[model samples]
Target: MRPRRFGARTGETQLRSEEYRLLRDLISERLGLFFGPELRSSLERRLRERLGVRGLDSFADYYQLLAYGAAGHEEWDEAAELLTTHETYFFREDYQLRAFQQEILPLLAKKERKRMQIWSAGCSTGEEAYTIAMLILDSGLFEPLADWEIRVHGSDLSKRCIAAARRGIYGGASFRATADVARGRWFVPSLVEEGKSGVSASVRSLCHFAQMNLLDDERTNLVGKCDVIFCRNVVLYFDAAARKRVIDMFYERLVPGGVLLLGHAESLLNVSTAFELLHLKEDLVYRKPLASTAKP
Candidate 1:
């Protein structure tokens, strides 16, 4: 597809064919964010703001900055913020969470390892990770400090998002689906903002946040193996090849019999077959078998 001939609107940047291909391919390769031709306009619109901030007149300059620029790392961090969707709320898609609480927790509780960890991959602003901690508490399957080790690790690609997640303070739509009782139980009124609420120290204690690009093998390894991984709505943005790579990393990161929970709109079809499909009472999940081996 050719470049987008931007409208006469002020402060717009023309994304040429070569530049579009270079930028999008680099984006996919670096961050796993896809930009098909249908999204060219939207992509251009968003990056246009970035270009303005950089005072660059062409997408090529932006591409060079992202590719090999000295500030490439920091620039890519900013690009991640621009390209990704960070909007999320507590208790979203409660059905999947219900399956985690009733079905998955019991199964995990039976494991030999007393240290249980659930990684919230691509958690935006920490809502999902905090949500997982709440579920774990509700399960009452593991004691907090007596003999059980519980950790809910939240990670995202954007530093800004990680910072927000670390704060554990949220307002507005972040709590829309959250029950008032649950909110009262798990959160305290935040002095940071009149309408905001801080996630309780009990929940925050069980969780931690970090900024990680899933492609970074070093950082990925630092996450350590987990008992459950919630990568909902994150991998869909990646192209097939990138998706495969990320899925394989996840495979390596999960312990035996560990399960993966994805967004309802996502699935493993055509992505990877390493995970076995689990049909739960209220949701479908992927699991690594207790005695699993490589397919080929």
Candidate 2:
């Protein structure tokens, strides 16, 4: 059957009351991304393009495609990429990072473990994970950790972003917040793309990437426990319930005494109370309680 076509003005129709509720609810349930009344037009505009692509004239039809179509799963994935934000760059939040480097790393170093793991949850294009690895290498704390296991894992909901991450190549915009010293030390000229550079083999060696939905319990479990988790700027998109759920998952994924770093705009104030807020010289971070009364 020929796909339905829509006129310029027809596609511009406001998302209907029922359609808005249906689409928003479905997206929230599946992806944990909440779109409220304020975002109604935004959601309508973004999905209208999808409807045009699919040759469906109405938002209702698009909802049917997402909810009951033969390729519903694939459709959801595409919609997710469209709806989610991937605005990130290397060393985007320097203050929190400085705290992680100056204060947190030293504390972890004292543990004297054979393996160390750091997770960049919601890691968009892999910069955060690579940055953590670079900092670890720069700290020179791991020199004494030779023969020890060290891995920085980055996970995101966008498959495309994860693919870009695994390739380990980036261009100028991804380096906007990056320092020249870090750029010089951790990346070399890219062989495949002119004017682009790939993360140095040494940095890439310690990092891994995977496509994962933060709301997926089984897949999230694969992330296991980590010493530090960077989930900055991600929970802002979620509603209260979704935010709480994700926070609970983070708590589960972090080992005792593990650290949780959030964006400057986000905090656990009412979202959660399980974590203790620790103030560092550069930033404030959260941590799980240690088994003992004090640092081991």
Candidate 3:
């Protein structure tokens, strides 16, 4: 179907082809969020909600506000949150978690006189980072009870999500895949809201949260080198170039021999990454090879 035309008055719902291209490209460039032609209707609908909020008549006006307005920088944050999906939960992609717990953590245990860091890049609401903490504790490798500097940093583009993550509270949906034993062990019953739970003190102690854009060089450099990085389903929102950019950033962040775990839907198949495809018994993962290790 053809896109609707820009209307002459208020409450207009139109997003012309020119407007869509400008807005789509601007969003993709600024936020690394890609919406193909097939998603034009959905994109328009989402932008339509923004127009009403900004008191604009058309998506073109909204695009101008986003592209050239004084508040454009701030507006990009809102657009990022709206356009991106944040559907993460504790213990997502069980197979990948299994691979990490069963095979990877033991491998990291071999590293002597070194701190362990794991980054949950694009962590939506902090569940994944906490899960990593819980898994580390379960393995009994890290001496989490001691003063070991094991840090699980969780970063996301959304400031709002970061705030919620810091709060360390989650709703029922975030716990659907979680088992009763884990729930009883790792979470405390919510005082503010029923049916919600706060991440346990032990889990909270090991994790840190930050509001970060994957494309921002300065912020990523601040992450330092990590032993493992769990980026999961976040990268599928980006286009080819954006995907490569993110993959490269992941490589830089990881220490040599560090492993990267992605969602079942994501892979480095077509991307030119330095990461070697590491095969595990339960799953396939990518590992940044050590200086002595050759490409597989």
Write one digit per residue (lDDT tens) for candidate 3, span 147-233: 578899999998998999899998889998999999999999999988789999988989999999888889999999999999887
CA RMSD of each candidate after superposition: 3.1, 5.0, 4.1
lDDT of 1 at 122: 89
TM-score of each: 0.94, 0.92, 0.92
Compared to the true structure, candidate 3 yields what TM-score? 0.92
Candidate 1 Cα errors over 4 Å, as ranges: 1-11
What TM-score, to 2 decimals, does candidate 1 have?
0.94
Clashing pairs in 1: none
> Model 3 lDDT vs. the true structure?
0.84
lDDT of 2 by residue, 1-296 (tens): 00112233353656899999999888877777888877776787778888878999799999999999998989887887777768788888898889999999988877756678899988988988898998998998777546668889999988999999999999999999987888998999999999999999889889999988888999989988899999988887787887899898888888898999999889987888888888889999999887634321
| lDDT score for candidate 1 against the true structure | 0.85
Query: How good is model 2 by TM-score?
Result: 0.92
Give the alpha-carbon lDDT of every model. Answer: 0.85, 0.84, 0.84
- Name the lDDT value of residue 24 in candidate 1: 87
**Clashing residue pairs in candidate 3, if any?**
none
